[model samples]
Target chain A: MAESEYILEVKNLCQHFTSGRGRKKLTVKAVDDVTFSVRRAETFGLVGESGCGKTTTGRTVIRLYNPTSGQMLFDGRDIAGRMNRKLREYLTSNIAMIFQDPIESLNPKMTIEEIVGEGLKVRGNRNKEDIRRQVVQMLNKVGLVEEHATRYPHEFSGGQRQRIGIARAIITNPKMVIADEPVSALDVSVQAQVINLLNDLKEEMGLTILFIAHNLSVVKYFSDRIGVMYYGHLVEVAKGDDLYQKPLHPYTRALLSAIPEPNPLTERTRVRIDYVPERDHDYSLEHPSMVEVEPEHFVYCSPSELERYREIIQNA
Target chain B: MIYDRNNLPEELLNLPASDFEALYQEDIKDEKFQTKPVGFFKDAAIRLTKSKVSIIAFIIIGIIIILAVVVPPLSPYGFNDQNISAKYLPPKMPIVEKLGIMDGTRVLKNRKVSGLSDTDRYPEGSIIEYFNVVTAKGQEMCDVRVDAYMLAGMPDGEYHWFGTDYLGRDLLTRLFKGARISLLIAFFSVLTNVFIGVVYGAISGYYGGKVDIILTHFAEVLDGMPYIVVTILFMILFGSGMVSIILALTITGWIGTSRLIRAQFYRFKGREYVLAARTLGVPDRTLIFRHILPNCVGPLITRAMIAIPGAIFSESFLAYLGLGIKPPNPSIGVLLSDGQSVLLQYPYQTVFPAILISVLMIAFNLFSNGLRDALDPTKRGEE
Candidate 1:
């Protein structure tokens, strides 16, 4: 694989949400110093449990909640700088996000046409006919027909609304898309349909996707590269197959072991690993940071543990 | 029925390959909606009509508004036309006259029984009857029933459906004319209140943080002003005209709407659709007007409708305090104040105006209640 282009580069990104003032002030480090990158035309899956800041990382990358600190470079443009009209324009024109909840993400009052065409309208496409034409085409690409355009979001079922959301995000033809658990809210049967549609679109348009989901199996099936986050920090990053087969980090192992086996007999005896950060690592002795254990495989560990991870890779 | 996989039953083993088919669809598409598209207002309208009480109230209001606009010009007796001789006539409708109710006859208590037949004191056909004669200290006295119209010597063919007030002005014409003026004030005040409230609240709630804090403090300061004092100041500045009264009503009146709108904005601003819009780089103006504001419209419209009756009542209260529309330009309040002075002598004068205002208030209130239920999306299709 000679592809060397990185479409988006995020370095030490932090997103902290704070409320109140002075004595009563409180802060939540939702996304802490997390770093990763997405290559052009590649799918990067971010997997984490609830409240692990995977979603926060995706939102911060799209500049939804402005970064508290850290730097983000998209196509070599500094996006983590101060938010101004020009930066906002630049960010919106390139990157679009698909929210998690299908019902919550869509505007209930707007027609499907208006909801999907809104992206185009924001980009200065004011011709009603042109917008309608493009919107219908995008809807069809997502397996919805032209007739559904005039209908409100509430009329459609969950899966259809999600498809409409996908249409809204990709209609602008952005180089990168942040899909935040797009199919987690859908039924199992509908989930495959949406994933396949996304795969086809990604291939058709050469789109780089930052796919965020808690579902390990879905990410395993969809991602070219995978990053595992735990409690506001990324603990492992590797190819999809390598991460699934040889999870180097303790948290990654615990997450992989948690996937229930299909066979009743094997499932009954399946070993589930529990990871306690304090017991798993001696952070007092040395600070733990990201270290490359193999080519294209990075694990978060201190100097001593990094030696062990490198040995494990060399043995395999 | 249990067959081993290694040695399956002949029929099961021989099952045709053609029998197997996939239920999983490769592509999913939504079915076309069979019903016509129902927009926000259309949905609200459908729900509103389902409420029987609201429909009745709406019709009553429509008729009253139509009459308020149509009655004053059509009625023969001008609202201010006064004839001293025709003072204090009872309602003398020609049709209801034969029915013996409101037949223009009134009982004259403590009259000399001998004077019942005196033509000069009681004109021809003026005396209806007399009864209950009592000898009070050798003076024979009785309650004498006489035709009030004839007692006042009004023309034979003439009639006053609501009768005349102490000023001898036609009550029906004056009451409806007052309704017209009162309705105008309510409508104008409510429109301005909603407009100012929506803009102010949108700015405060959408921009939140310091902008919200400063705007809220300003509104609180304004709200602290004593309402009556503000009205008094406005009256002094502008001379108690409709413009002055409407301005007074609006000064603090819009604060409620602003608060309501502000709360609605705060609730909706954090919704995912709004976040999505922000991520899409939608300008703040569009986000405020299109995304967040439309959701608030359901409550905003309901609030505006409810504000009408409140404004009308406030105007009447001002008029009651002798600050209503300038004299001779009748409002319900002015008519009411006039009727109050002669309440004992002419109860009909007070009764008619009182009944009209009461009906107007109740109608508006019921109609607005229906509108609230209708506009609530959660209550859609509910009876």
Candidate 2:
């Protein structure tokens, strides 16, 4: 197979978790048949309400959680099969994850050097000086000094720790990073600092990031293309501007309306859209699947709703 | 909570976007910490030093340990030395004789006044005073206080600081020596218990489900077994010595440590750092020992400290039950058992050992409590 421009392609990815057995067997489809693609060196922002499978999709793509049934292609190689040592090595080496909670992401017992240098160490780089040098360099890249490498995670603030998390993730020189809500637990001022840092690092390293977050505005600003998810389904996919200008799915529209505008004059006039799927879509008689509403814009809708969305976009 | 130049949102409802503008534009360079970095252990040590109760307890423990090491060999009497004639000798000190406390005095009651004058039965100048006299059946019975050392035919300048036992073993020498054995047993058994417990609990707690259930149930069943019965089994198989006794303590002792470690692993294995390590492709062994285990070291160390006293007490109890370290080999419990038999006659024998054991127990208990407080992260930087 020829190499595709898209670095990671996940098709019909379903991650279902089952607990107990026999009479009381219960299954939770956290990510049910979610499909999306991340191009090489582009930020693919996934925005949703809490428990909408955004984090699960990112984890599933990174092979943290094994997909229940799907086809995931990383660099044109199938990764959605049974995990072996070789497959795990390939996945982890190419893809690193940045956790949400900065305090929780870094090990408290370890120094910054150990935490950041771990990927290299695990990959069989036994030279101490080499690892230390690289760790120091990575720290510098994240605007940290060599002295900071000796300090523990608890010594640093939330934003600093998140930067350390970023440094640790990208230090291994992974092609793709699954940043799971990297700035949800930081102050607004600190949030901008981290985001700017991530933006700079992304440009420098040419890293493809599957940025999963609930905050729509950050996702909109950071992401080149954005996918909106409702429940366990991918509701819409479009460019950042297209997603803002014309949100095709009702759920996406509802998520968009929730973003508080900066202008007080416009804020008062803002209409809140509540997405009641039962009231919005009638899928009993008609079947719906992901459809191309316009070039570079996709929405999950039945025929009647697709026509309506098309008319809305044309009018806009 | 997104706040950038374009995506400010309503976070700045009261404040202006310019407030965050400087932070967004500025590069992320972290400031150097003003104070010196305090590591977890250094932090704990600092906190521990601040607790005066712990400091005093620590000093007492240190003194006891030093005496345990220094007192036995330097003493005039060996641990098992038998001066058959000098059995039940009262405590004596040279300078203290003027004050009359532990001055080797014994009150002789129901002694006939005629017998008191007899030099053969009562040594010459041994009788100090006749406190009470009774005349009955034309016989004079008197109670006189005598210098016990002179009564026992001990030479001048000879003294027994803690007196002697029924076997004429110096109570002070035997007590310290027994403390040595008891402490060693506690140290060794605790080491073994923690090692076994950590490994067992790591596996059980890290790998939950059927394995955890089976291992947990097995530990419960073993926990149900009578420790006395287990000790008895060890006595039969290995015979009672330091090894057998340590094994006896270890057989069931590790269950608590294992339970502690298991619970700790259950708490820490799911922590985000462990997950981060897992995502980094850190192997299972590294995850278990390095990632999750280190996080719970404070609690583990405290548990081990508490377990030291527990092991010592268990050993003492076994010795009291007549299953202690073999005869002539002194343990605190063995000495206590021997002293309790002659408790009424020579309460001094029981008193000295009893005091040392109580001090040891109290000191250890206090030390562990202080350690728990010191190591507790929640109480960090507090008084």
Candidate 3:
């Protein structure tokens, strides 16, 4: 792949936290050696269960949490752990985040205008009129009116609040947006509306998105390529449709089987596959690393398993 | 049949395509009726006015303030003025005298004259008469008659409203002046405490980890100290005055506010909104001041209002113990202490100051309660 084709490429990213005190000190690997690349203007979905470090990875990429050790290349420049003011400012302005909970993501004390225009103000847009105009434009684009700008977040419904969150994220015209389970908190009906709005905005703004969620179905619908994580490790990466049809990793297969089908016959007949690390592989003998099994497909497996996976793909 | 139906259906054929173009056009018109955004303080103020008890408390406080400012200077008698002749005079109502309801005049007879000459003692306009009087035991006695100048230049007989203290100082005037001193101390001490506490707490809370640990431990240590003991120590060290009392109150007083602010900061600092602001490249100063601090304002204001009454009470307690304001300055505490000594003899002295203190405390408490409810975000929009 050409270097400029990928807007963000993270290599060997690690974030470890120290817990306990003194002699009993322990390091919990929140994100361990995760590597992935997001192509320009393409959605890269990250799927994982609770405590699997999908959110951690998104945050670390945006420098919300400093990576313990890694290389993050944004716009072909290494931004991982770079503490300079200019680089920090550039990264923040270029990348924005949509948090999981809309109600908590917006300051209740601030009106919609201040919340949405905060980014512009931070980036040095001092003109009040200009900020107001831009905020109104963004709000309207997200299906809100000008009068809504003056109201507090508490007045809006969950769907409207999420739209405000979306407006705030995109008002600065960021090149990349990290949406961390943006619709997980909304009702099923509202979830579809929010997802559609995100999809529309993505196309209109040409934004590269790192979409993180535990819902595999939503991830499949929204992403071009998907990465499956388990216990702080990215176990598989493949095209969205390909991964759903033929999951390479055991964990991915297990996660896919958990999704209930609409047809009762298929739902009842579906067999759940559980991936336990102890029974899965002999890591003591040969440790697994992410390796390419096909042209654009990657899986975390040892030499023997990798050969098995390749043969299985060839047979299919 | 089809040909006949086509000929008859002119109404159906005349129907043109209905235009729905307006529906597709964006509804960008401004709202016909819009409400101006209500600010945090304005909303709180509206809520505050809704409570009747709070309004009554507010009025009481206002009246006290007016009396504190306007009453003392208008009194005929100075706070320290002493008239030995009027030392133990019971209150005599001037209105009653004018209406002839009572004759309050007192003529002292059968009393021995003093050694000082009558001409030298009495002022120029005085009328002094010497008379020989017979007592019940048939002993001869000399009596002196002198007309006394009472309140409003009334001679001898009149009512002394609120009476007088042991030294013949007007009780009403002293009470008003004492209120001024007490209120001044409360205001200053609360201001100092809140200023120090907020700054300390904001810094401690915003910069967590090592800075938080150190500062929190320091606050805990200060909190562990006995309040009255510390106050007494400060009084002894700095000597008794307004400055010393305020310093003593503030030293430990701010710890509560600081802790409250610090706890509030901790709760808000981890909130997603604050994190969102941080991710938006907002400077640390703006994040602390604009984002985090403003949310803490409601609780902080309520806490500060409650602290004012605590300060006033502390001042009075210290003054009552004789370690507060000096004698002539007349704090409520000082008045109470003096009144308590002669409480059995002249109960009015103790009763009057006690009533004032009770009213002040109740008013402050009621007002603070209203403020808390008004500023609470959770209670907003509820009746």
- The structural similarity of chain B in model 2 to the true chain B, as TM-score, is 0.92
| Worst lDDT 10-window in candidate 3 chain A | A261-270
Better of 2 and 3 by TM-score: 2
Query: Over the stretch B89-156, how does candidate 3's per-residue lDDT look in tens digits?
Result: 43445566466322233345565445214455454444346677545555556665444333124454
Clash total of candidate 2: 0
Q: Tell me which residue pairs clash in candidate 3.
A: B92-B158, B92-B159, B93-B159, B94-B159
The interface RMSD value for candidate 2 stands at 6.4
TM-score (all chains, Cα) for each model: 0.95, 0.95, 0.85
Model 1 residue runs over 4 Å out of place are: A1-4, B1-25, B381-383
lDDT of 2 by residue, B152-246 (tens): 88888878888988877788888999999999999999999999999999999999888999999999999999878878988989998899899
Candidate maximizing TM-score: 2
Candidates' chain A TM-scores: 0.97, 0.98, 0.98
lDDT, candidates in the order shown: 0.89, 0.89, 0.83
lDDT of 2 at A180: 96
Residue B240 miss distance in model 1 (angstroms):
1.1
Worst 10 residues of 2 chain A by lDDT: A261-270
